[model samples]
Target: MSRMIFVNLPVENLDRSKRFYEAIGARNEPKFTNEAAAMMVLSDTISLMLLTKPFYATFTSKRIADAHSSSQVLLCLSCESPAEVDQLVEAASANGGKADPGPKQDIGGMMYGRSFEDPDGHHWEPMWMDPQMAEAGAHPVESATAVSN
Candidate 1:
């Protein structure tokens, strides 16, 4: 079996966050989701464990990062193309989220990534990449990437 990674996020409202993800075409896995948290399936092997704030608080002694006033971290996800990047950003806006108001980056034939923030101010990045940029004999990053060609 392939090694799967689950990124867990602290959300204020499990149901609300679930709806936001659903608005952007993500599906919830009932087998791993409930009122306390929702398993957002980003792909076949990648999932997000969206845990409620109190539930998430158990994971750390330090306070959870504030998602409204300031952000100390940014979560990045890959997109299929530059267009998909734009579309996802737009969708986020329509679903009560906002843009980061920055320029798109071109990494000279290697990669391109854009960032967005959720309703709670958690950052999400959409990146496009080229397979030729793979390191030596590595397979690839589990996160999907958008390619020009």
Candidate 2:
């Protein structure tokens, strides 16, 4: 079986978050979707499970962090190119989201990333990596967010 990732997040209003995500080209999967939550199809291997506050709380006993006041996560999505990264970030803004002052820029490796905070202030990072540049660097990844020795 192929390993996949389902990034789940809590939203104040399930329907409102659904609309915001749908406007950005994410398809909604209604099979498992309900008033309490919506499944946003990002790709075959990746999906985002958007759950309402109550539904989300069911998964954990810890108090949910207030995204508008503090961040608990940064969702990162990769694009085919830097252009795609920028376009998606712009799309988020068009659909009522906030953008960071500047994006992660690694021109030498042809990699670039930008961040946007959703309506609820959940941070998301849109990014791209150029294969050719990566090859030139002799390493697949260099500017990773975290360093491991």
Candidate 3:
């Protein structure tokens, strides 16, 4: 079996976080979700667990970082196309999410990306890449001109 990843985040409002994840295309895994936590399935092998701050505290003794004030980690996902990346960013922003002020990334013609901050201030980046260029180990700028149909 392939390895699976479960990214856990502490949320101030479990319901709001679940809605945000669903708005961004994640499906709710009710079997693993409850009032204190929610399981948002991103892909076949990727899932995100949104836990209430108090419940999440049980995992570690360290203090929970205020995501709105400080960035703890950036969650990024690969999209099928540039349009899909934009779509996700748009949806997220329309649904209680904020656009990241960071510069947009367009690595030549090989990669395109944008990011958004969820209501709880968690960062999520959506990106699209040219598979061929990546497989060929092509330089960002050089490959833009080299890759041809």
Candidate 4:
């Protein structure tokens, strides 16, 4: 079986978070959803489990970091094209998410990306890369630095 990734996040308002995710194209997987948590499926291999603060606490002994004030991880998703990347960011903004939480990235026309923050401040980046450039082993860091200079 193929391995799947399930990202668990703590949400302040489960219903609001679920709605935000749905607006951004994720569908709720009712099989694993309940009052304290909702399973949002982003793709066949990627899913998000949105849990209430109390429920999330039960899973971890550490204090939950306020995502609105601090960040723990940056989530990224690959897109088919630059337009798609922009579309996702725009959709996020229209649906209560904060857009452009980070600087926009364009690495020598080989890659393009934008970032946004969900209602709870979880950072998300949507990006697209030239397939040919990727196959050629083009280095993003090298191109990004070159573009900045």
> How does each model score on TM-score?
0.79, 0.85, 0.90, 0.93
Per-residue C-alpha lDDT of model 2 across residues 43-92, encoded as one tens digit per residue? 88888899998999999999999988886777888888888888888888
* lDDT score of residue 4 within candidate 4: 100
Candidate 3, 26-66: lDDT as tens digits:
99999999999999999999999999999999999999999
Clashing residue pairs in candidate 1 (N, C-alpha, C atoms within 3 angstroms): 80-146
Best by TM-score: 4
Instruction: Encode model 1's per-residue lDDT on 1-149: one tens digit a residue.
Output: 99898888888888888988888778899998877889998888788899998989888998888777777767777777767877888888788777754456655646676666777778887777665654532344434344332
Give the residue spans of candidate 1 off by over 4 A.
Answer: 101-103, 108-110, 134-149
Error of 4 at 65 (Å): 0.6
Across residues 1-149, which tens digit of lDDT does each residue of candidate 4 receive? 98999999999999999999999999999999999999999999999999999999999999999988998999999999999999999999999999998988878778888999999999999999899887877565564542321
The window of 10 residues in a row where model 3 has the poorest summed lDDT is 140-149
Candidate 2 residue pairs that clash: none
Q: Where is model 1 poorest over a 10-residue stretch in terms of lDDT?
A: 140-149
- Predicted structure 2: lDDT: 0.80
